[model samples]
Target: MFNNLGNLADMMRNAGKIRETVEKATESLGQLQVEGTAGGGVVTAKANGRLELLAVRIDPKLLADGDAELLEDLVTAAVNQALTKAREAAAQSLSSLAGGFPIPGLSTLLGPGGGGGA
Candidate 1:
């Protein structure tokens, strides 16, 4: 029974370590930048690995043209693409840390596809 208790203690320690590693990884992920473009570069979107949209760029010509509908569509497309890239980067970063152990719920969080992209 003492041996079992020791094993449980070890498991708890390892779990704490894993949690710390994951926390650091998640924090760093927000610093990562990703860009996505649409309309053949007419519009570009930037985001962090946390999937937060940061900024957007529009070609001077597009704005000059004054096509509100087209501009809106392009902006939406760019933002969506940027978000996808951010999610992918965040997932990859997280998966690298979680891959070391067979932690319950971690697999599901990372997903079965294993690419770790949303």
Candidate 2:
């Protein structure tokens, strides 16, 4: 009975450590940024590791062309690219926090590029 209680305590402590590590990693990730471009650099987007869109830029040439649909497509592509980069950065951060050890369910949680090294 005493051994079981000790084991439970140890498990709880490890769980606390994991939670702390995750929180720190998440906070750190938010400070990182990534950029993505589309339409041969006519459109660009920037995002944070938290996957939040920061800013966007469009070439004045594209604006002058005034094709609404084309501009929309370019913007979409840029945003998607930026998001992909953000996910990759996040995965890298989490992997480091895990000490490169494969954390169960972490890969799935991180999505496609959220595994292995950062």
Query: For this target, which candidate reaches the highest TM-score against the unseen true structure?
Result: 2
Return the lDDT, model 2, position 69.
100
Candidate 2 lDDT tens digits, 1-118: 5866775666567987887888787788779999999999999999998788999999999999989999999999999999899888888778877765566666665567676733
The candidate scoring highest on lDDT is 2
Tell me the tens digit of each residue's lDDT in model 1 across 1-118: 4866776667687987878887787688779999999999999999997667899999999999999999999999999888777767767777666663444554344334334432
What are the root-mean-square deviations of the candidates from the true structure over C-alphas?
5.3, 5.3
Give the lowest summed-lDDT range of ten residues in model 1.
109-118
Pairs clashing within candidate 2: 92-118
